[model samples]
Target: MLLSVNNITIAFKSKKVVENLSFSVDRGQSLGIVGESGSGKSATALAIMGLLPPTGRVTEGTIELDGTDLLTLLRNQENYRGRKIGMIFQEPMSSLNPLFTCGYQIKETVLQHQAVTARQAEAQLTSLLEEVQLTRQLGERYPHQLSGGQLQRMMIAIALAGNPDLLIADEPTTALDVTVQAAILELLNKLRRSRNMALIFISHDLSVVRQVSDHLVVMYRGRCVESSSVAEVFSHPRHPYTRGLLACRPRPHLRLLYLPTVKDYMEERPDGTIVEKMPDNPLLGATRGSYSPSQFDPLLKVENLTVSYQNQINVLHSVSFEVFPGETLGIVGESGSGKTTIARTIVGLLPLKSGKIYFQNYLLGKARPRSVTRQIQMIFQDPQGSLNPRMTIGEALMEPLHIHRLYSSRSERRQAVIDLLTKVGLEPDILSFYPYAFSGGQKQRISIARALIVRPSLVIADEAVSALDVSVQAQVLNLLKSLQQQFNLTYLFISHDLAVVKFMSDRILVMYRGKIEEQGIADQIYQQPQSEYTKQLIQSIPQYV
Candidate 1:
């Protein structure tokens, strides 16, 4: 085996984060380590890469690379880290250095391990960029100059600089769009086969892992619940955790009302261990009652909407759409495809270069009135960023109510906040706590509550559930549907995830380069996409099969 981890247990201070995990990968083979956050998949990768935090230490077992212990090599960082084991981290933007050019980083890495001359390293940098399907010109640009996919490709080039025996990709394609993700996976597989390198692919995404790995190791709460070949695991998963994960993925063809949660298949053992038993995967259908059948009454309208940065960089090009009451109008596109621009323009956050915006059949002036702001609420992509860190949950939610002067009485506002908190599946006690105290999913629920507290008719959810895990995403989606039913709220749901858009949207609009490629009912659009872009987007969805 090129890489062998034998019954490894990792700990930080008194707490054991990972326990008795074992896996092996031969040259040109890939092993997939998959689980939710805190399940020790990334911990195991860190243990192998010797990049764990200062407090984290491997307490048991041995990690061997071709019979040599990695623990011993950790003592000499220069000896094995860059030379033997290359790693691609989760976030490309953070993983790459912004100060230096992509070429400089790759060249430096090559020089560090191979002892190559400056000219030779430069040549090697060019070769690496080309190997990763990047142009030499792009290497000269800084990290910010490149797109997400480009930055990720640059990261892969850097990882391949020393031509390490094994590459550890930790959630490499998590942030990427479907097409970009497929390209990266293909590139990794190609490089792995060509270089004859072993791989440790760690991700929460099972379908992505299935595409790259031969062996699958399913983890739950720091334990490897099941380990087997990818084919076997997918076809005949014995563990309930694995089955739940398989069923949780939102399929392109199957429009599920709600995804199966991990709790459904799990029971607490007497000793505190989670006993996982396979459950029947039920296909539940959602009613379209929340969506208004009659689309004649439009709640919001955008006509010839054009957005640009400094009157130079054109973003949205004559973008026009109407959001009807009690219906979700989903805008589907990749990054920089002007999806959020429409949302921002509608919310009056961005000044349109030339456009007309009508809310409730009334034309919005140069700047939308405070009344419009109160009626049209927007939920951003990053829940944490949208919320104030210094402010408590109560303070945050109360700001909207306070701005509108709906409830002049503080006591009444507090009561409303408590009720809104309960509606979003959060308790009143949490109102005292800060945003940091909440998980990503919980923070999103808080954001939703903040949006709804004003009693807005139109809600622009801009990639709201993109960052959340599958089960949490399901919960949030269910909550959105239920709230929509109760409030009769009009929704402008924006996302790059086609499956999610299909599930939530009454009507789907495919956007590419600021232009609408196609627009139709969700079922018809997913089933019979007329545009090539839409067809490609649907096909790119990662399938468990």
Candidate 2:
């Protein structure tokens, strides 16, 4: 075995996070660690690399690289950190230095491990970028200048600078477009074979893990619930959590009226024994959206909408679309496809150069009225950035009410906030906690509550559930559907995920390079796409084997 971890226990400040975990990987083999957030997958990677924080440590067990104890190397300070093992972090934007160019950063890494001069390091840097299917010209740009896929490629180049035998990738393809994600996976597998490198791939998305992994390890809360070959686990899941993960993803074949969550399958008793139950009937009364645009007048109309950046570069060009009442319009494309710009334009965040926007048949000028503003609200991609860290949940939810002057008294507004919290599956007592205290899924729920508190007519959800785990994503999607039915809401949903967009939208709009490629009924578009761009997007979606 190239790497072996036996009976390992990891802890932070004397509190155990990963207990009795064990796994192994051979040369030219890949082991996938599948779990949600806080499942201890990343912690195990850190322990193997000897990169744990000061408060964290390996409390017991052994980590061996080719039969050499890793813990002993750490104590001796002669470790094989960059020389024999490399790691690609989850978020490249945070891991890379913004002040330096990509080429400079990678060159530095190459120089650290190799006894090469500056000129020789430059040659190696060029070769690394080429190996990852990136251009050398892109190397001179800063991290922000590169797209999501390009940045990930740059990170791979840096990790390969050491020419290590093992690579640990933590959620490497999360939140990327489907095509970009597929390309990155292919690149990783290619590099692994060319170099005979062992890999530890970590992710919350099971479909993604299925594409690259040889063996699978399913984790929940800090324990490995199931371990087996990838095909065996998918064919017959022994653990309830594993079954839940497999059944929760949005399938491209059809739409489920209500997606099943993990809690619907099992429950843990007070004594720590698990009780299994039959999964909820996800296909009961499963139906597709039947809204007809010809019946009702358009709720929102955009004609010749165009938006430009501060540098006078147009990101959106002559875009036009209409959203009918009580229907969802899904917009999908890759990065730089103006999917987000259209959402910002509808919500009055950007100024149009020459176009007309009519909400409720009222023309929206450069300066929108308060009535128009209250009727249109937006949910951003990153819930953590959208919320205020210092404000309590109660205060954050009530601020919109205060601005709109909806309720008569402060007490009435407080009650309204509590009611909204309950609707979103959160307790009233959590109002006292700050945003940082909640998990990613919980924070997204809070964001949803804050958006719906004002009772808006149109809700623009922009990549809202892309960052969530499959099970949490199912819960949130179901919640959104329920809320839509109860409130008679209209959603202008935007996502790069084709399957998700298919599930949520009545009509689909394909956007490519700031232009609308095609728009039609959701089912028709998915079954027989007219445009090559739409077909390509659908083909890029990862399929389970």
Which candidate ranks first by TM-score, i.e. highest?
A: 2
Candidate 2 per-residue lDDT, tens place, 1-545, comes to 99999999999997899999999999899999999888999999999989899999999999999999898886653347877888999999999999999999999999998889999999999999999998999999999999999999999999889988899999999968999999999999999999999999999988999988999999988899999999999999999988888878877777567776788778889987778878656654376655456588999999998888984888888999999999999999998999998888888787777788999999998788888899999999999999999899999999999999899999999999999899999999998899999988999999989999999999999999999998899899989999999999999999999999988888999999999999999888999999998998999988865
RMSD of 2: 1.5
Candidate 1 local lDDT, 1-545, one digit each (tens): 78889999999998999999888999989999999877898889888888899999999999998998888775586677878899999898898888999889999899999978999999999899999999999999999999999999999999999889999999998888888999999999999999999988988878889999999999988999999999999999888878778877777676566666666677778886777755554534443333335537688888989999899988989888887888888999999899998898888778889989899899986766788888999999999999999999999999888889989799999999999889889999998999999899999999999999999999999999988777677778878987998899989999999988988888899999988898888888999999999999998898888
Task: Find the candidate with the highest lDDT and give its number.
Answer: 2
Task: After the best TM-score superposition of candidate 1, give how far the Cα of residue 462 lies from its true spot, in angstroms.
Answer: 0.8
Q: How does candidate 2 score on lDDT?
A: 0.91
Global lDDT of each candidate = 0.87, 0.91
Give stretches of model 1 more than 4 Å off: 269-271, 276-295
TM-score of each: 0.96, 0.97
Which residue pairs show backbone clashes in model 1? Answer: none
RMSD (Å) of each candidate, 1 decimal: 1.9, 1.5
